[model samples]
Target: MAERADAARNRQAILQAADKLLRDHEPGHISLDQVAATAGVGKGTVFRRFGSRTGLFQELLAERAARLGAAVESGPPPLGPGGPPGQRLLAFVDELALLAAQNIRLIAAHERACGADPHSDPTYQRWHRHLRGLLSELRPDADADFLAHIVLGGYNGELVRRITASGGVPRLRIAVRDLAQRVGDVD
Candidate 1:
Protein backbone atom coordinates (compact mmCIF):
# COMPACT_ATOMS: atom_id res chain seq x y z
CA MET A 1 0.00 0.00 0.00
CA ALA A 2 2.78 2.40 0.85
CA GLU A 3 4.53 1.56 -2.39
CA ARG A 4 1.31 2.17 -4.33
CA ALA A 5 0.89 5.56 -2.72
CA ASP A 6 4.47 6.51 -3.52
CA ALA A 7 4.00 5.44 -7.11
CA ALA A 8 0.85 7.49 -7.40
CA ARG A 9 2.60 10.55 -6.01
CA ASN A 10 5.49 10.10 -8.41
CA ARG A 11 3.11 9.82 -11.35
CA GLN A 12 1.28 12.96 -10.31
CA ALA A 13 4.55 14.82 -9.98
CA ILE A 14 5.63 13.75 -13.43
CA LEU A 15 2.31 14.77 -14.93
CA GLN A 16 2.49 18.14 -13.22
CA ALA A 17 5.95 18.72 -14.54
CA ALA A 18 4.97 17.74 -18.03
CA ASP A 19 1.89 19.93 -17.92
CA LYS A 20 3.95 22.91 -16.78
CA LEU A 21 6.42 22.42 -19.56
CA LEU A 22 3.71 21.95 -22.14
CA ARG A 23 2.09 25.19 -21.02
CA ASP A 24 5.40 27.01 -21.02
CA HIS A 25 6.62 25.69 -24.34
CA GLU A 26 5.04 24.23 -27.43
CA PRO A 27 4.18 20.55 -27.10
CA GLY A 28 6.47 19.55 -29.95
CA HIS A 29 9.38 21.57 -28.62
CA ILE A 30 9.31 19.95 -25.17
CA SER A 31 10.85 16.51 -24.84
CA LEU A 32 10.62 13.56 -22.47
CA ASP A 33 14.07 14.34 -21.12
CA GLN A 34 12.82 17.74 -20.02
CA VAL A 35 9.77 16.22 -18.43
CA ALA A 36 11.84 13.65 -16.50
CA ALA A 37 14.39 16.23 -15.44
CA THR A 38 11.65 18.61 -14.33
CA ALA A 39 10.07 15.81 -12.32
CA GLY A 40 13.43 14.77 -10.86
CA VAL A 41 13.05 11.32 -12.36
CA GLY A 42 15.28 9.35 -14.70
CA LYS A 43 14.39 9.50 -18.39
CA GLY A 44 13.82 5.75 -18.26
CA THR A 45 11.04 6.34 -15.77
CA VAL A 46 9.20 8.61 -18.18
CA PHE A 47 9.54 6.07 -20.96
CA ARG A 48 8.42 3.27 -18.66
CA ARG A 49 5.40 5.22 -17.48
CA PHE A 50 4.16 6.77 -20.74
CA GLY A 51 5.86 4.72 -23.51
CA SER A 52 6.37 7.67 -25.92
CA ARG A 53 5.76 11.32 -26.62
CA THR A 54 2.36 10.63 -28.08
CA GLY A 55 1.35 8.68 -25.00
CA LEU A 56 2.52 11.49 -22.76
CA PHE A 57 0.53 13.99 -24.79
CA GLN A 58 -2.50 11.73 -24.53
CA GLU A 59 -2.15 11.65 -20.77
CA LEU A 60 -1.76 15.40 -20.65
CA LEU A 61 -4.87 15.90 -22.77
CA ALA A 62 -6.77 13.42 -20.62
CA GLU A 63 -5.66 15.31 -17.54
CA ARG A 64 -6.73 18.60 -19.06
CA ALA A 65 -10.05 17.17 -20.16
CA ALA A 66 -10.65 15.75 -16.70
CA ARG A 67 -10.05 19.17 -15.19
CA LEU A 68 -12.33 20.68 -17.83
CA GLY A 69 -15.02 18.18 -16.94
CA ALA A 70 -14.74 19.09 -13.27
CA ALA A 71 -15.00 22.75 -14.11
CA VAL A 72 -18.16 22.12 -16.04
CA GLU A 73 -19.49 20.03 -13.21
CA SER A 74 -18.96 22.77 -10.61
CA GLY A 75 -19.08 25.89 -12.77
CA PRO A 76 -21.73 28.61 -12.56
CA PRO A 77 -25.38 28.22 -13.40
CA PRO A 78 -26.40 27.27 -16.95
CA LEU A 79 -23.10 25.40 -17.14
CA GLY A 80 -22.67 23.33 -14.00
CA PRO A 81 -26.36 22.79 -13.48
CA GLY A 82 -29.72 24.43 -12.78
CA GLY A 83 -30.80 26.16 -15.98
CA PRO A 84 -33.22 25.85 -18.83
CA PRO A 85 -32.09 23.37 -21.47
CA GLY A 86 -31.73 26.03 -24.14
CA GLN A 87 -29.67 28.20 -21.83
CA ARG A 88 -27.46 25.27 -21.01
CA LEU A 89 -26.92 24.62 -24.69
CA LEU A 90 -25.77 28.18 -25.25
CA ALA A 91 -23.60 27.98 -22.17
CA PHE A 92 -21.86 24.91 -23.54
CA VAL A 93 -20.98 26.68 -26.79
CA ASP A 94 -19.78 29.79 -24.95
CA GLU A 95 -17.60 27.76 -22.63
CA LEU A 96 -16.22 25.71 -25.49
CA ALA A 97 -15.37 28.84 -27.42
CA LEU A 98 -13.45 30.10 -24.43
CA LEU A 99 -11.56 26.85 -24.04
CA ALA A 100 -10.55 26.88 -27.71
CA ALA A 101 -9.32 30.44 -27.41
CA GLN A 102 -7.20 29.57 -24.40
CA ASN A 103 -5.63 26.45 -25.86
CA ILE A 104 -5.72 27.13 -29.57
CA ARG A 105 -2.05 26.52 -30.27
CA LEU A 106 -1.64 23.49 -28.07
CA ILE A 107 -4.87 22.06 -29.37
CA ALA A 108 -3.82 22.60 -32.96
CA ALA A 109 -0.55 20.86 -32.24
CA HIS A 110 -2.33 18.07 -30.45
CA GLU A 111 -4.75 17.64 -33.31
CA ARG A 112 -1.86 17.46 -35.73
CA ALA A 113 0.31 15.19 -33.61
CA CYS A 114 -2.10 12.77 -32.07
CA GLY A 115 -5.02 12.80 -34.52
CA ALA A 116 -6.67 10.14 -32.43
CA ASP A 117 -10.33 9.22 -32.16
CA PRO A 118 -11.93 12.40 -30.89
CA HIS A 119 -15.40 10.93 -30.67
CA SER A 120 -14.12 7.75 -29.09
CA ASP A 121 -12.82 9.69 -26.11
CA PRO A 122 -15.16 9.14 -23.21
CA THR A 123 -15.38 12.78 -22.19
CA TYR A 124 -16.08 14.00 -25.72
CA GLN A 125 -18.52 11.23 -26.43
CA ARG A 126 -20.35 11.93 -23.20
CA TRP A 127 -20.56 15.64 -23.90
CA HIS A 128 -21.73 15.07 -27.46
CA ARG A 129 -24.40 12.60 -26.40
CA HIS A 130 -25.44 14.69 -23.43
CA LEU A 131 -25.93 17.73 -25.62
CA ARG A 132 -28.04 15.72 -27.95
CA GLY A 133 -30.19 14.52 -25.09
CA LEU A 134 -30.58 18.05 -23.76
CA LEU A 135 -31.42 19.37 -27.19
CA SER A 136 -34.07 16.71 -27.53
CA GLU A 137 -35.57 17.70 -24.23
CA LEU A 138 -35.51 21.33 -25.28
CA ARG A 139 -36.96 20.64 -28.70
CA PRO A 140 -38.59 17.30 -29.28
CA ASP A 141 -39.39 17.86 -32.94
CA ALA A 142 -35.89 17.91 -34.41
CA ASP A 143 -33.54 15.01 -34.84
CA ALA A 144 -31.67 15.50 -31.58
CA ASP A 145 -28.36 13.86 -32.43
CA PHE A 146 -28.07 15.43 -35.86
CA LEU A 147 -29.06 18.84 -34.59
CA ALA A 148 -26.57 18.54 -31.75
CA HIS A 149 -23.82 17.64 -34.18
CA ILE A 150 -24.73 20.54 -36.44
CA VAL A 151 -24.59 23.07 -33.62
CA LEU A 152 -21.33 21.71 -32.27
CA GLY A 153 -19.82 21.48 -35.71
CA GLY A 154 -21.10 24.83 -36.90
CA TYR A 155 -20.39 26.86 -33.77
CA ASN A 156 -17.94 25.15 -31.46
CA GLY A 157 -15.65 23.39 -33.91
CA GLU A 158 -15.16 26.49 -35.95
CA LEU A 159 -14.23 28.62 -32.96
CA VAL A 160 -10.54 27.90 -33.10
CA ARG A 161 -10.30 28.43 -36.83
CA ARG A 162 -12.35 31.58 -36.71
CA ILE A 163 -10.34 32.93 -33.80
CA THR A 164 -7.09 32.19 -35.57
CA ALA A 165 -8.33 33.75 -38.75
CA SER A 166 -9.83 36.78 -37.08
CA GLY A 167 -7.19 37.09 -34.32
CA GLY A 168 -9.85 37.18 -31.59
CA VAL A 169 -12.84 35.55 -30.04
CA PRO A 170 -15.14 37.69 -32.21
CA ARG A 171 -18.81 37.97 -31.32
CA LEU A 172 -18.97 34.22 -30.81
CA ARG A 173 -21.31 34.35 -27.89
CA ILE A 174 -23.76 36.59 -29.70
CA ALA A 175 -23.62 34.50 -32.82
CA VAL A 176 -24.13 31.34 -30.79
CA ARG A 177 -27.04 32.91 -28.96
CA ASP A 178 -28.66 33.91 -32.21
CA LEU A 179 -27.98 30.51 -33.74
CA ALA A 180 -29.49 28.77 -30.75
CA GLN A 181 -32.56 30.96 -30.92
CA ARG A 182 -32.97 30.19 -34.58
CA VAL A 183 -32.55 26.46 -34.01
CA GLY A 184 -34.92 26.44 -31.06
CA ASP A 185 -37.53 28.32 -33.01
CA VAL A 186 -37.60 25.54 -35.57
CA ASP A 187 -40.69 23.35 -35.29
Candidate 2:
Protein backbone atom coordinates (compact mmCIF):
# COMPACT_ATOMS: atom_id res chain seq x y z
CA MET A 1 0.00 0.00 0.00
CA ALA A 2 1.13 3.51 -0.76
CA GLU A 3 0.53 6.63 1.24
CA ARG A 4 -1.12 9.60 -0.36
CA ALA A 5 1.07 12.67 -0.68
CA ASP A 6 -0.59 14.48 2.19
CA ALA A 7 -0.50 11.38 4.37
CA ALA A 8 3.16 10.90 3.65
CA ARG A 9 3.89 14.52 4.55
CA ASN A 10 2.04 14.27 7.83
CA ARG A 11 3.76 11.05 8.78
CA GLN A 12 7.16 12.55 8.12
CA ALA A 13 6.27 15.59 10.18
CA ILE A 14 5.23 13.50 13.13
CA LEU A 15 8.29 11.27 12.92
CA GLN A 16 10.54 14.30 12.74
CA ALA A 17 8.94 15.88 15.77
CA ALA A 18 9.13 12.64 17.69
CA ASP A 19 12.77 12.30 16.82
CA LYS A 20 13.47 15.73 18.24
CA LEU A 21 11.48 14.97 21.37
CA LEU A 22 13.36 11.73 21.87
CA ARG A 23 16.57 13.72 21.86
CA ASP A 24 15.32 16.28 24.41
CA HIS A 25 13.27 14.17 26.79
CA GLU A 26 13.32 10.66 28.12
CA PRO A 27 10.69 8.37 26.61
CA GLY A 28 8.94 8.35 29.96
CA HIS A 29 8.31 12.07 29.72
CA ILE A 30 6.76 12.39 26.28
CA SER A 31 3.00 12.89 25.91
CA LEU A 32 0.67 12.91 22.95
CA ASP A 33 -0.18 16.56 23.46
CA GLN A 34 3.47 17.51 23.35
CA VAL A 35 4.00 15.46 20.22
CA ALA A 36 1.05 17.15 18.56
CA ALA A 37 2.36 20.61 19.34
CA THR A 38 5.86 19.69 18.30
CA ALA A 39 4.62 18.37 15.02
CA GLY A 40 2.39 21.44 14.58
CA VAL A 41 -0.58 19.18 14.09
CA GLY A 42 -3.82 19.02 16.01
CA LYS A 43 -4.42 16.53 18.81
CA GLY A 44 -7.01 14.82 16.67
CA THR A 45 -4.53 14.52 13.88
CA VAL A 46 -2.03 12.92 16.21
CA PHE A 47 -4.63 10.45 17.34
CA ARG A 48 -5.60 9.78 13.78
CA ARG A 49 -2.02 9.05 12.88
CA PHE A 50 -1.17 7.16 16.06
CA GLY A 51 -3.85 5.62 18.21
CA SER A 52 -2.03 6.38 21.46
CA ARG A 53 1.16 7.75 22.88
CA THR A 54 2.57 4.27 23.13
CA GLY A 55 1.80 3.57 19.52
CA LEU A 56 3.55 6.73 18.47
CA PHE A 57 6.57 5.83 20.51
CA GLN A 58 6.59 2.33 19.10
CA GLU A 59 6.55 3.64 15.58
CA LEU A 60 9.25 6.18 16.36
CA LEU A 61 11.56 3.70 17.98
CA ALA A 62 10.96 1.12 15.29
CA GLU A 63 11.72 3.68 12.64
CA ARG A 64 14.93 4.63 14.33
CA ALA A 65 15.99 1.03 14.74
CA ALA A 66 15.09 0.27 11.13
CA ARG A 67 17.20 3.18 9.96
CA LEU A 68 20.15 1.82 11.86
CA GLY A 69 19.47 -1.61 10.49
CA ALA A 70 19.33 -0.27 6.98
CA ALA A 71 22.62 1.49 7.45
CA VAL A 72 24.22 -1.70 8.66
CA GLU A 73 22.57 -3.56 5.81
CA SER A 74 23.78 -1.22 3.07
CA GLY A 75 26.43 1.28 4.09
CA PRO A 76 29.72 -0.55 4.53
CA PRO A 77 31.68 -3.63 3.70
CA PRO A 78 31.79 -5.26 7.10
CA LEU A 79 28.40 -4.12 8.31
CA GLY A 80 26.76 -4.57 4.95
CA PRO A 81 27.34 -7.35 2.40
CA GLY A 82 30.89 -7.05 1.11
CA GLY A 83 33.12 -8.20 3.98
CA PRO A 84 34.16 -11.70 4.93
CA PRO A 85 31.89 -13.52 7.35
CA GLY A 86 33.94 -12.83 10.51
CA GLN A 87 34.25 -9.12 9.86
CA ARG A 88 30.56 -8.79 9.02
CA LEU A 89 29.51 -10.57 12.16
CA LEU A 90 31.56 -8.28 14.40
CA ALA A 91 30.33 -5.28 12.53
CA PHE A 92 26.74 -6.20 13.40
CA VAL A 93 27.52 -6.09 17.11
CA ASP A 94 29.50 -2.87 16.85
CA GLU A 95 26.65 -1.21 15.00
CA LEU A 96 24.05 -2.52 17.42
CA ALA A 97 26.08 -1.29 20.37
CA LEU A 98 26.28 2.18 18.90
CA LEU A 99 22.52 2.24 18.32
CA ALA A 100 21.70 0.95 21.77
CA ALA A 101 23.98 3.49 23.38
CA GLN A 102 22.38 6.32 21.48
CA ASN A 103 18.79 5.35 22.21
CA ILE A 104 19.07 3.51 25.49
CA ARG A 105 16.50 5.43 27.48
CA LEU A 106 13.96 5.47 24.71
CA ILE A 107 14.42 1.77 24.09
CA ALA A 108 14.14 0.92 27.77
CA ALA A 109 10.98 2.94 28.14
CA HIS A 110 9.44 1.40 25.04
CA GLU A 111 10.28 -2.09 26.21
CA ARG A 112 8.62 -1.33 29.49
CA ALA A 113 5.57 0.37 28.01
CA CYS A 114 5.20 -2.16 25.24
CA GLY A 115 5.52 -5.10 27.68
CA ALA A 116 8.01 -6.71 25.32
CA ASP A 117 6.24 -9.32 23.22
CA PRO A 118 9.03 -11.85 23.05
CA HIS A 119 8.85 -14.36 20.16
CA SER A 120 6.18 -12.16 18.60
CA ASP A 121 7.84 -9.18 17.06
CA PRO A 122 9.63 -10.15 13.87
CA THR A 123 12.37 -7.61 14.51
CA TYR A 124 13.53 -9.34 17.67
CA GLN A 125 13.32 -12.75 16.11
CA ARG A 126 14.93 -11.63 12.85
CA TRP A 127 18.09 -10.34 14.46
CA HIS A 128 18.62 -13.65 16.19
CA ARG A 129 17.88 -15.60 13.04
CA HIS A 130 20.15 -13.46 10.92
CA LEU A 131 22.95 -13.78 13.43
CA ARG A 132 22.55 -17.52 13.52
CA GLY A 133 22.61 -17.69 9.75
CA LEU A 134 25.81 -15.70 9.64
CA LEU A 135 27.48 -17.88 12.23
CA SER A 136 26.31 -20.99 10.44
CA GLU A 137 27.85 -19.71 7.26
CA LEU A 138 31.13 -19.06 9.01
CA ARG A 139 31.26 -22.29 10.99
CA PRO A 140 29.48 -25.13 9.31
CA ASP A 141 30.19 -27.57 12.14
CA ALA A 142 28.23 -25.83 14.90
CA ASP A 143 24.52 -25.71 15.65
CA ALA A 144 24.00 -22.36 13.99
CA ASP A 145 20.52 -21.60 15.28
CA PHE A 146 21.44 -22.36 18.86
CA LEU A 147 24.68 -20.45 18.60
CA ALA A 148 22.81 -17.45 17.19
CA HIS A 149 20.35 -17.45 20.05
CA ILE A 150 23.05 -17.68 22.70
CA VAL A 151 25.27 -15.00 21.19
CA LEU A 152 22.44 -12.57 20.51
CA GLY A 153 20.97 -13.09 23.95
CA GLY A 154 24.33 -12.49 25.58
CA TYR A 155 25.04 -9.39 23.53
CA ASN A 156 21.64 -7.90 24.35
CA GLY A 157 22.13 -8.55 28.05
CA GLU A 158 25.40 -6.67 27.95
CA LEU A 159 23.85 -3.87 25.91
CA VAL A 160 21.14 -3.20 28.49
CA ARG A 161 23.64 -3.19 31.32
CA ARG A 162 26.04 -0.77 29.67
CA ILE A 163 23.72 1.66 27.86
CA THR A 164 24.51 4.35 30.41
CA ALA A 165 27.69 3.36 32.14
CA SER A 166 30.84 5.36 31.52
CA GLY A 167 32.62 3.98 28.45
CA GLY A 168 30.26 1.04 28.55
CA VAL A 169 29.48 0.88 24.84
CA PRO A 170 33.04 0.92 23.56
CA ARG A 171 34.21 -1.66 26.07
CA LEU A 172 31.18 -3.82 25.41
CA ARG A 173 31.69 -3.62 21.66
CA ILE A 174 35.23 -4.85 22.10
CA ALA A 175 33.94 -7.68 24.26
CA VAL A 176 31.31 -8.53 21.69
CA ARG A 177 33.85 -8.75 18.91
CA ASP A 178 36.15 -10.92 20.98
CA LEU A 179 33.30 -13.17 21.95
CA ALA A 180 32.12 -13.43 18.37
CA GLN A 181 35.61 -14.35 17.22
CA ARG A 182 35.79 -17.03 19.85
CA VAL A 183 32.45 -18.44 18.71
CA GLY A 184 33.60 -18.44 15.11
CA ASP A 185 36.96 -20.00 15.86
CA VAL A 186 35.43 -22.99 17.64
CA ASP A 187 35.33 -25.02 14.38
- For residue 170, what is the lDDT in candidate 1? 53
Which lDDT tens digits does candidate 2 get at residues 40-123? Answer: 888888899878766776777677679657855687777787778787888887777666667676666556556656434455
TM-score for each model: 0.69, 0.74
What would you estimate as the lDDT of candidate 2? Answer: 0.72
Once superposed on the true structure, which residue ranges of model 2 sit more than 4 Å away at CA? 52-54, 71-76, 139-143, 154-164
Screening candidate 2 with a backbone cut-off below 3 angstroms (N, C-alpha, C), the clashing residue pairs are none
Q: Candidate 1 lDDT, tens digit per residue, 86-181?
A: 777777777766666666554554554555654454545666776787788888988888776666554333356574466466565556556766
- What is the C-alpha local distance difference test score of each model? 0.67, 0.72
lDDT of 2 at 177: 67
| Regions of candidate 1 where Cα sits further than 4 Å from its true position | 1-3, 29-34, 47-55, 71-76, 154-167, 170-187
* Superposition-based RMSD of candidate 1 using all C-alpha atoms, in angstroms: 3.9
